[model samples]
Target chain A: MSKPFLSIENMTQTFPDGQGGTLTVFEDATFGIDKGEFVCILGHSGCGKSTIMNILAGLAEPTSGVVKMDGFEVSGPSLDRGVVFQNYSLLPWLSTLKNVTFGVKARYPDWSKAKVEAHAREYLAMVGLEGDVVHRKPSQLSGGMRQRVSIARAFANHPKLLLLDEPFGALDALTRGTIQDELLKIWGGTEQTVFMITHDIDEAILLADRILLMTNGPFARVAESVEITIPRPRNRTDIVEHPNYYAIRNHLVQFLGQRSKELAGQQSGGEPQSPTRVVIDKTGPAPDPEPTTKPQLRAVND
Target chain B: MLDNLSTNQRAAVLSVVMLVVGLLIWEAAIPAQKAASELTEYERLTGGGAPKAGVPPPSQVLAKAWEQLSNPFYDAGPNDKGIGIQIGYSIYRVLTGYILAALIAIPLGFLIGMSQVAYKAFNPFIQVLRPISPLAWMPLALFIIQDSEASAIFVIFICSIWPMLINTAFGVAGVRQDWVNVARTHELNGIKTAFMVILPAAAPTIITGMRISIGIAWLVIVAAEMLVGGTGIGYYVWNEWNNLDLTSVIFSILMIGVVGMLLDSAFGFLQRAVTYAE
Candidate 1:
């Protein structure tokens, strides 16, 4: 296999409890993502998925680990990594256009005004927001609309990596589905690398090139990295009829169920010993399968 | 939705209804409202012989007001400054004092509010001086400044500071942590974050404090002018009282109420303009 684009090696993080005891969240966890890969991480409530994302983004520190992107170690957040948060973190005082353009202006201050506006408008329209709303403040927008603005803002800069921490978690089911479809469409066509955290099984299967599952914490580790076998441009409705869909879903369900049982037992003192080896299902074949057709990757603005 | 009624119309309707009701009560209380005055002036109106007193009815007050308004500046000659001049003078002083208080108070309050160390250092001094009355400052201001206008202005400045200062501090302190985090994520350092994010986020509270300060400023001005003896509406009321002209005194009091109402309404509009309601 070719060298991975982003790599996290032996990452561990701990915090002092202020009572002379230390709380360890992750321990020597290692993972790597290839260029333009879309990965979703699924975990239970205390799984430290967000903590891992924060460390990868350089917003938080791991006790011991190296996060390397394209062979360069990440010391802090940079324009190359754009993050979209769960609550649609659009600055309320700025108009939709300004919010979207904020990143562009900061990252490319030398760009012409027309260039900046065109760049921002392209992304905003890609996210399905009309130009009329470009001048309106975030407070004037609905929740879903605000989240779309956030997505537009994140994607406008054309970052090398997009990090989403349950970006649609606060939306209604219908809204979430619409957003999920939009996100898949945007990510699929662009070949943009995405790393997201979610608890929803359907969301993971629908969007991810691969899914990383984590065990529950005080000490969590990447339990498995399951590759979705369903073909490209995967439709949620059609994928259900695929031969391996149910089998993959059942495998994930059982894996999570067993982990939940283990976590419960450990909490209740019903089990003492730690599980020696974590099984991360890579689904079918071990390396990636060769493509038989010309990939139809399209940049969002185009 | 009643979109036909603009915000101004709604407020105007409510204000008009309140004013009418107040006028009716004043009319009804004419006898009682003037009872103290009528008791003393009974001998003169009754030709020094009777108990029946002559307390002017509400109609008589209006007649005098209308008579005065017909040629409002006849008493002032060609200078021709009607009640508007008195109002203008009072407004000028209030604007100067209130603006000075806001300019000084807001920054000071923000500093104290943002830093726990500054808050501890200044909190005691604020607590001690805040409760001291504007009238209490009048004598000291008069002696130090030795100018009636300056003294009255100083008194207003003292009276208005506490509310504005406290409100600014509260506003700055109450800024949402989420907003701060967003600012931090954008690489906005401390000063840029404070002015760009915190100030706007806390604007509503700061404006509310300014509203309270303006009200106090209006309240302080009347008393300050009365003590310092200036050419303000307060002094006009006092001058009328020395001549025993009860109607002019009543007229001046009405003017003060109207001016205060206008000042309050203007700030209310400003408050609504700056707020971005979540």
Candidate 2:
């Protein structure tokens, strides 16, 4: 296969456990995201999913390994990789227009004030916020609106990659669905590469082109990559009725519900092998056309 | 009349009524001074007929207050100026010292807050110097500076610095880590992040510190001026005391209260301006 647009090469993260011993968060986890691909990582809490995202965003460093985008090694934060934090991380003092403008101006310093503001307002309008609401501060907006502002800020930079850490995790279910639709619409038009971390199985299936399932940590690894076979223009309401939806959904739910904990306990003492690829049947539940071998597990050193 | 008043208005009316009642009681309590049978040598030397022990009646204070207010800007000499001039001198000293403290404290505070090394190195010195009274520095200031006015100003500087310095540091350090993360994700440099993100986030708290410093500065200036014996409101009060003129002293005390309130309210306005809901 040709080189992916973004490559995570054997990234490992460790922290001191405060007893003069190191705690491994994850070890030698490897993955790659192709250009313009929408990928979601699914893991239970404390599985080092955010740690991996942080490394990709260049907000943190792995214990050993490198993340390269295109040809250059990622070192620190850049406007090229925009992150949408779960907390909505809007600078509360500024209005929505100013908040988006702040990032746009930072990304394109040569752009005039009017041009920057117009660019920011365009993105804000794309997220369904316009008119007087764009002038309101984050505190004045509802939780959903604030997240939309964060999304606008991230997209306004026209980043090469978008990193979302459970962006809709804090919103109500109704609001989450609406924003998810809006997000899908935006992503469909732009074809931006997205790496989102979410534990919601259906959300991953609906939003990501490929869903990466991670085993539970301390020696956590990406166990498998499930390719969603659903067709485009999928609706949250109609997507569930699709023939392949339950097959993909059941496969993900089973891994998270049963296999994740089992794999956590099964590791014996060597390096973790990279995740295997699993292609779901598009028509209906059927035996795999090609048999894929399970990854070799090893004992973990404590 | 009381039915339409809000809680604050009712409270204000009660305060005036209480003041009137207290003044009435004071007026009735002191009997018209009896003719003096014998005067002590000290009393004769100072002033033969001045009331020695009784608190001055409210009527005499009111009359003195009116006289001072009518010609507040009069400058008779260095030792004797009108109430307005005395107040103006006191305000000038407090502002000069307070502003000097802010200039030094704010930038140092930002440095200490942002750098762990600076915080660790400077914290002990701040703690050591903070608790010493501003007036306790008056004698040293007077001896070293050899200028009473400068000493008083220095005393105000010393008293005001701690709150602003400590508050600013606290405010800066307490800025949300998520906001800093946002700055980092945006690739904002250290200077831009500090000025654009941290400063606004810490502003309300910094203003709180400034409000506190102004209050302490105002309080310290009075006692410092009293100690240094300069031409300020404090000196005016002291001079009136030497002549045993309780009415003028009482009037000046009221003036001091009014000026302190004005200073505090001015800072309160600034504090409100910078305050954000989130």
Candidate 3:
């Protein structure tokens, strides 16, 4: 296989467990995300999902491993990787448009002020933030709107990789659906590599090209890379109609519900633990897709 | 009629009534001045014709205010300067000292706030120095600076520095880690992050500190000027007392309170500007 666009090689993270023993949040975790792929890692709390996300974003370092993008080792935060934090970390003092422009200006310093502002307004528009709404500070916005501004800020920077730590975790179901759709639409246009962490199984299935299932900590490991074979434009309402949908969903549910705990706290014995690839396909030749899965079906040909 | 007014308007009306009532009570409480003819030979011989040194009525103080305020900037001689000129001198000293304090405090506060080692190291010194009265510094300042004017300003500076420095450090240290993480993820350089993120994040608290410092400086300036006794409103009050002109002294005291309120409200406006709801 070709080298992935972004790769974490044997990344381990441990903390002093307060009794002179080290707590291995996750050990010898190895993963690769292909370019233009939307990958999500789902595990219960204490599984070190956010730790891995922080490592990938270069906001934190792994205990004894490296993160690389485009074959360059990542040592610190860069414009190449943008993060949408879990709490919708938009600067409260800046208006929604200025928040986007803050990142845009940093990413493209040579760009003119007018260009930066226009670019900010455009991405904000994509997230359904426009006009007066864009001028409101984050505190003035609803939870969903704040998250949208955060997403707009990240996307405006055009980072090679976008790291989202449960972007929809704070939203209600309806708001989550709307923002998820907007995220998918924006991601479709940009084709930027994405790595996200979420606890929601349905959200993972709906958005990710592949789902990386992580076992629980203190010896957490990435156990499986489950491929979501549902074609785009996967509809929130209709993706379930696809034959591969429930099969993949059930496998994920079974893994997270049963196997995650069963496989928890296992040492890989100094071996780099990569996920076992599991692809579920129930389509026959010229398999039919539901008409509602439009924009268009990127059919996984059987 | 009062029921039709808004809360603020009603409160204002009540304030006016209280002021009038207070003035009427004050006017009535003063004993009638002894007639010059009723004074004994000894009192007359000792110049009892002059107004006795006592708390002047509000009406007398008001008349003095009108007289002094009419031509405040007249500088006839050293001890006999106008109220305007005296207030102007006091304001100059307060602002100069306050600005100098801010110049040193804010940047130093940021440094201390950003580093745990620096914060710990500076804490003892701040603790020791902050509590000493600004007036206490006057004697040492007089000896060292050797100029009363500079010494007065120095006293104001020393007095104002503590609140601003402590508050700034607190505010800067208290900036949310999430916001700093946002700056990190954006790849902002240290300076850029400080100016764009940390500064704005800490500004409200810093301004609060500044408000506190300005109030302290205003309070200290009066006392410092009294001790130094050169050209401030504090000196004017002292000089009026020495001359036994209680009307002028009361009027100067009223002027001092008005000026302090104006100074504080200026910072109040600034505090409101920088404040953001989290």
Candidate 4:
């Protein structure tokens, strides 16, 4: 089979548990993401979602295995992979315009002063940060606006892989809803490949083309790849009304609330643990393709 | 009427009231001098009527201020240099030594802040040396440098260096890792990262250090010039004491205060410039 644009093979990470023993966070985990795909990884805390994101960003290394993008092995952080951290990590000292321009200039150093500025302003405008608002520092901005600038900064670079580690985690639900809509607006046109970690099931469904569900850790692994069957141009209000939305969400909710823990720490015997492929479509006549999962559900039912 | 005034205007009114009250008391406290006509000829020749040698009243000091300020740069001899020239010399020494200290301390502090090993290695020396008085180095400095002027500068340099070095290291070391990670993901080189991310993040802290250093430098220069004893405001004050010119001493003391306040406010402006709310 042809390799996907980005692939992880047998990734494992362990830390000395400070008692002269090792604690394995995750092991023999594997996955692949095709170009232009929006993938979200969902798990309860401590399932090593962030560790996986870090490894992909080149900010960290796993104890074993490798991550390759575009036919080459990933190493230390590069401009190609941009991250929007949970804390909104906008440089507090710079104005809104300069923060975006700071990244644009670094990514395109050869661009002229005016061109760099115009490019930055273009992206800033995309996030609704124009006029006097761009001149204010991050500290001067509200939490939602700062995140918008951070989003602007990340998107302006047009990175090969954009990583969002719960970028809206710090904002209130109201503000979160607004930025999510704004994010959807910007992301629709960019077709940027995204890998995000989210705790919100509704959010995972709202934004992701596919949700990669992780089993609970110490031997946690990517357990299932669940595709969102609802057609796109999806909105927060409209998506919940779709027949397939709840079908996909319920399957995810069951796996997370039950199977994730039941399946935790079961190191599969001597093989890479690729997630099972799942497709849920209640819109039409019942058609389940993966017969292997039927008995597993039966066992859980019993 | 007071209720109608703004806060700053109210404060200004209070300050003027306090000044008038204090100056009136000062002017009233001196004993009255007997007229020359009332004194015996022997008392006159023997100078029993010499002006009382005590704290000069504000009026006398004011008059002296007008005289001295009118030709502040005039130079006749070492003992009689103008207030402006004397103040100019002191400022020159302070700034020279301060700037020298900054040129070395800032970069060194950046190095120490960036490296845990360097910070640990240098901590012992800084702890041991920082508390020793800058004046205590004078005898050693004088012997080695063999020039009083340079030794005085050296004193200012030593006194000013510690605060700057320590503060820079602290500020630089304390910069958030998030910012650094941002730099890395941007593919910024080491130089660019240091300039773009690390410097601005640490700047408020570093400028705080600089403000402290300048204050110390100003304080030390006065004492240092007193020890070296030739051509500064410190020396001028001492020289006036020797001449028993209480009025000039009082005036120069005020000038010292005025100059120090200016230096401090200059840094205050810089600190505000670099400060961010977060």
Interface RMSD of each: 2.2, 0.9, 0.8, 0.8
Measured against the true two-chain complex, the DockQ scores of the candidates, in the order shown, are: 0.29, 0.69, 0.78, 0.79
lDDT of 3 at B82: 94
TM-score of chain B of each: 0.81, 0.90, 0.95, 0.96
In candidate 1 the C-alpha lDDT for residue A66 amounts to: 82
Q: What DockQ would you assign to candidate 3?
A: 0.78
Ordered from best to worst lDDT, the candidate numbers read 4, 3, 2, 1
TM-score for predicted model 1 compared with the true structure: 0.81
Instruction: DockQ winner between 1 and 3, please give it.
Output: 3
lDDT of each: 0.78, 0.88, 0.90, 0.91
Top-TM-score structure, candidate number: 4
User: What are the clashing pairs of model 4?
Assistant: none
Q: Which runs in model 2 stand beyond 4 Å of their true positions?
A: A265-272, A284-302, B1-4, B34-53
For residues B241-265, write the lDDT of model 2, one tens digit per residue.
9878888888999999999999999
Model 1 CA lDDT for position A83: 84
Q: Can you write out model 1's per-residue Cα lDDT over B1-278, one digit (the tens) per residue? A: 44789999988988999988887887787654334445556555665434344455566667766765665443374223466566667778888998999889999999988998998999999999999988888878878998889888888888888999999998898887657656655666689788878898888899999999999899878777677664677766777677666776677787789888988999899998888856
What docking class should model 3 receive? Answer: medium
How do all the candidates rank in terms of DockQ, highest first? 4, 3, 2, 1
Per model, the share of native interface contacts recovered reads 0.17, 0.76, 0.86, 0.79
TM-score of chain A of each: 0.86, 0.92, 0.93, 0.94
Candidate 1 Cα errors over 4 Å, as ranges: A1-3, A62-66, A112-114, A131-140, A260-302, B1-56, B63-82, B143-146
Compute the lDDT of residue A95 as modeled in candidate 1: 87
